[model samples]
Target: MPVTAVDTDTDDLTMTLVGDFPAPAGRLWRAFTDPRQLERFWGPPGWPATFTQFDFTVGGRARYEMTSPHGEKSRGAWEFLRIDPENGFEVLDGFVDEEGNLTDELPTMRMTFAFTDTAEGSRLTNTTYFESAEALEQVVAMGAVEGSTMALDQLTAVLSDLRAYAEGKGTRTELISDQHVRITRLIDGPRELVWRAHTEPELMRQWMLGPDGWRMTVCEMDASPGGRYRFAWAPEEGVAGEPFGFDGETLLAERPRRMVTTEHMTDTDYPSTTNDLSLYEEDGATLITTLIEYPDKETRDAVLATGMTDGMEASYARMERVLLG
Candidate 1:
């Protein structure tokens, strides 16, 4: 939300992004300079970046990889061109290989990140210069605008204490796009236990029930890549709704960190959704983010209209109070 405007000029072969933050210039500057803070927002929501080498000197280079939920890696590098403390910096950004060597898979660009003081707080002016209009159009068609905006929006949370930013927020849902929805909750427990609650059959049965009347009748799980899981719930005696279940296969799992799965309604031809689950722990608590990608906009809307968020809230509250506590 901090990103205020974006402008593209084919004639100039450039793209400019403007953002206003409530933090001062020094704070915003640190966020860009610190590798740890940069890792928090360098990529979009589901794809997180990890820096393998960060040399911040004027002539130095930094290498990082943004990893997708499906275990795909996109490597990149930044060669520092200019540096002015608390004011701005310039870097030549381009794709890199796994060995940290620059690659030509995508065109490179020069970028300038400038920070200045303002009455409200600080302003960030980011300008990217492309060698040609063709390169600019190519990057734009590759979702550069949406990805950059979403990445910067995540900086709002990173600018504050993460625990304070997320605690007590309960289960919240954000429609990321026509076919994608993100659900998040801050669990009041360690990452390991939270991961177990989702993977272990006994632990999952204890807290995965959506509502008070529902009881888990079947809970089968395998928390490994290519593994399959099935969960079914039935209403308690005297309750009304019929029994229902979901089955899914784990497409990827990174132990306590991230997992990607395909979920489908049992015994139905409904299109499956890819659920990307990621966990970030800080100060003894874990933040759980699940990005669900549906087949189409209609399917996404239908799933959200089912009061799915409310059910998830109830289930998560029970998890925190009964299982995590």
Candidate 2:
């Protein structure tokens, strides 16, 4: 197990777990920041977690559900209190209802996760501050210590698979749920330039084009919260595909790091998809992850059947070529 110790202090009304990992602090940071990587080990062995919503910013909230082997579920939410990139973060952790609302079923706690370099690798000091000694005892009695230890132990496998999320892996798509799909691409460019390539019209047209025969004909972007944007693509004169476009209104914009938008096909009454896009940089390269929530399984399947990931890979490959140049 990666966890070295689990200590409960009634005097301080807290529970602390210490874990040592072979990966560096940055890798650990990404594991926590990326929902896809995080879900891999956040829950205990039998109860796997799925983050339905992860904003990952100060004041932001993350909602997740850990489903048991027999379909029972435990929902939880984290209200981010402070974030210190690659070092630590503090959150108000609590249980939630099926609709994602906080509930009183379990005691809420303030948890702090601190990361530091160790002789062999990195160490994570995770301390949970309970409201009272009774709360600490309550959690312990519920097996929080054992559950957390097993969860942390699963991180070893996730950290060992470095190449799976490294740069040059090209565009990858994962069906996170029946209605949610996550797409990731590590671009060989800084976060600023990558963000610009996505927001700036001239830069966007240069790489957002999918496949060799098509070109972006319209690239209109507002890029501010609540602002609307539109994009259209047309096949080169001889190419056979029909022209297409998408329009969306930004829901949140956190500058070079995160953006949330509601997207819909232009001129269509189809329900919109909430696209949560996040960027993380490591070793000077930026990884772009977009979690798209479709209306239903049918819509998700229809979109995937349309060769979305293949087109995305082509566009992302083009992005590296143009952005790096």
Candidate 3:
């Protein structure tokens, strides 16, 4: 299923998800309300949630950990504002570090979750509010809304399995699908120039979002097997008029072409966005095809729908400039 989100200039943001679940409404409601209930259904089917604290009523708070297969982790928390039985609920969700320090960048604003009766099954609508335009843009780039859709899709199956288990049927294993990304680009420069743009720290920073303080603190790449690399790029703060370096990565080097990397942007609303970039030469130039293979399609589309394509194209243009400069 393709996951999607809204991109508009308004105070209200709404997302709707619908699926046919074998389990009843009450069961689904419990899956979301009870902390123990949530832990059972959170994360991608395999990556379970480790709940610290959870309360379903208004003003309640919950923290969770979703661990990836490679031992990487992404944490998030939500502040409950309302929980109206089986009909609906509302809360604000944002990023949290290992120590749970809420970053100054983003926070849980306000969100309303409504459950409706669909002919086939249930429809879930998640409406959110952001502090401003930039705030909305920030989270959109990080693929927040869409990831939840996949999480919930998995929830649907979880409920199905629970229903089957209740009926003495075997457990469900269809939810273990692998996620990946494919980024195909047509750069204006030659293959060597394209390679240099990504390999050189300063050049990578110019196009990629370098470190926050005009620094490339972690852009090391041996470009070989058994080699590891981490790339960081962000715009410097307090600059009168400077482009921001927003997205960066820590990559597992597979050399000369492919690598598994993590893209980190400040939104922190979602856990993590993993990417696999495959580079090759086409007609003397480079065709860098990147497979973003996100853990979920919703996260993929959420970030893609947010003009990420435009920004990345622009970033590539910047790479061209860096090469020419």
Candidate 4:
């Protein structure tokens, strides 16, 4: 997890937040500049954001809205004043109405974000200067502190996903057959690294744990065609229900290219499945295709209904962090 520290200096009419992420400055910089990435994490949890306008040049403007769980929308805008690659930028941030008109009643502030390299990773410091101490207090009273903290946390997750995609780990899924689900990802790293991450247990442990709060307690892999492998996952802390896992045997093994395996859950209603993974190189990026065949169409449909794709994509994003590291 990233560390976020927020400070408010009423005398200076400013609010400052400093955080550190285990990623490069360039990666973190994208989270701020890229519209797609910014929309994903610009708001706090339960209030997903959407960016309609993002012009990242000097004097450019951006308009976005964050929707709350209760179906309320809070719109905002930013006028860019400066742009610096891998370093930071300055913007005028303010509130807007549903019609995208700036709200005169709200206090607009000037925000500057600075990014720099650090021993741990990348350090981001944001200073928001208001016109007066009263203006600073106005935003703070509106839960700015908590909201910004949550937004930064979302930014960290976005950074992880972006890094993976940037490294050629972007993924897309399709249903090719009644019983098969195929997932394809472009990996920016070498095919060898992708192969090792899939075949090596130690490396697999770094990214295969389904989602956050889960850990692989058992990771056994035999890369040979006839070899068997088993992976068990449990909650980091004890949960209300029993832990679950899967085991399989390699059906085909082609180093740095392809592998076929059979997988079955240990304690679940889901049926067994077969996974065929093929890797190729295109323009120096590794293209990985994972085809999963379930026992039946019903089984495949059931898994998909459980939002399995989101979990798989999230896991792969975590894998990108491991590869980058």
Per residue, candidate 4 scores C-alpha lDDT tens digits across 135-210 of: 9988999999988886786565466643354444356776755876768666667789889999998899899877
Compared with the true structure, model 2 gives a TM-score of: 0.60
Candidate 1 vs. true structure, TM-score: 0.94
Among the numbered candidates, top lDDT falls to 1
Please tell me which model should have the higher lDDT, number 1 or number 3: 1
* Winning candidate number (TM-score): 1
Q: Is candidate 1 or candidate 3 better by TM-score?
A: 1
Model 3 residue 217 CA deviation (Å) reads 47
In order of listing, the candidates' clash counts read 0, 0, 20, 4
Error at 187, model 2, angstroms: 0.7
Q: For candidate 2, list the clashing residue pairs, or say none.
A: none
**Cα lDDT computed for each candidate against the true fold:** 0.91, 0.84, 0.57, 0.79
Cα RMSD for predicted model 1: 1.7
Residues 22-42 of candidate 2: C-alpha lDDT, one tens digit per residue: 989888888888997888679
Task: Give the C-alpha lDDT of model 4.
Answer: 0.79
Which pairs of residues clash in candidate 4, taking residues 3 or more apart in a chain or in different chains? 167-188, 168-186, 168-187, 168-188
Q: Indicate whether candidate 2 or candidate 3 has the larger lDDT.
A: 2
TM-score of 4: 0.52
**What does candidate 4 score in Cα RMSD to the true structure?**
15.1
Error of 4 at 285 (Å): 17
lDDT of 1 by residue, 1-325 (tens): 7999999999999999999998899999999999988998899877888888899999999999998867789999999999999999999999988887887768899999999999998999999999998899999999999999999988877777768888988899988889889898999899999999889998888888998999999999998999999999999999889898999999888888888999999989999999999887888989898999999999999989988999999999999988977
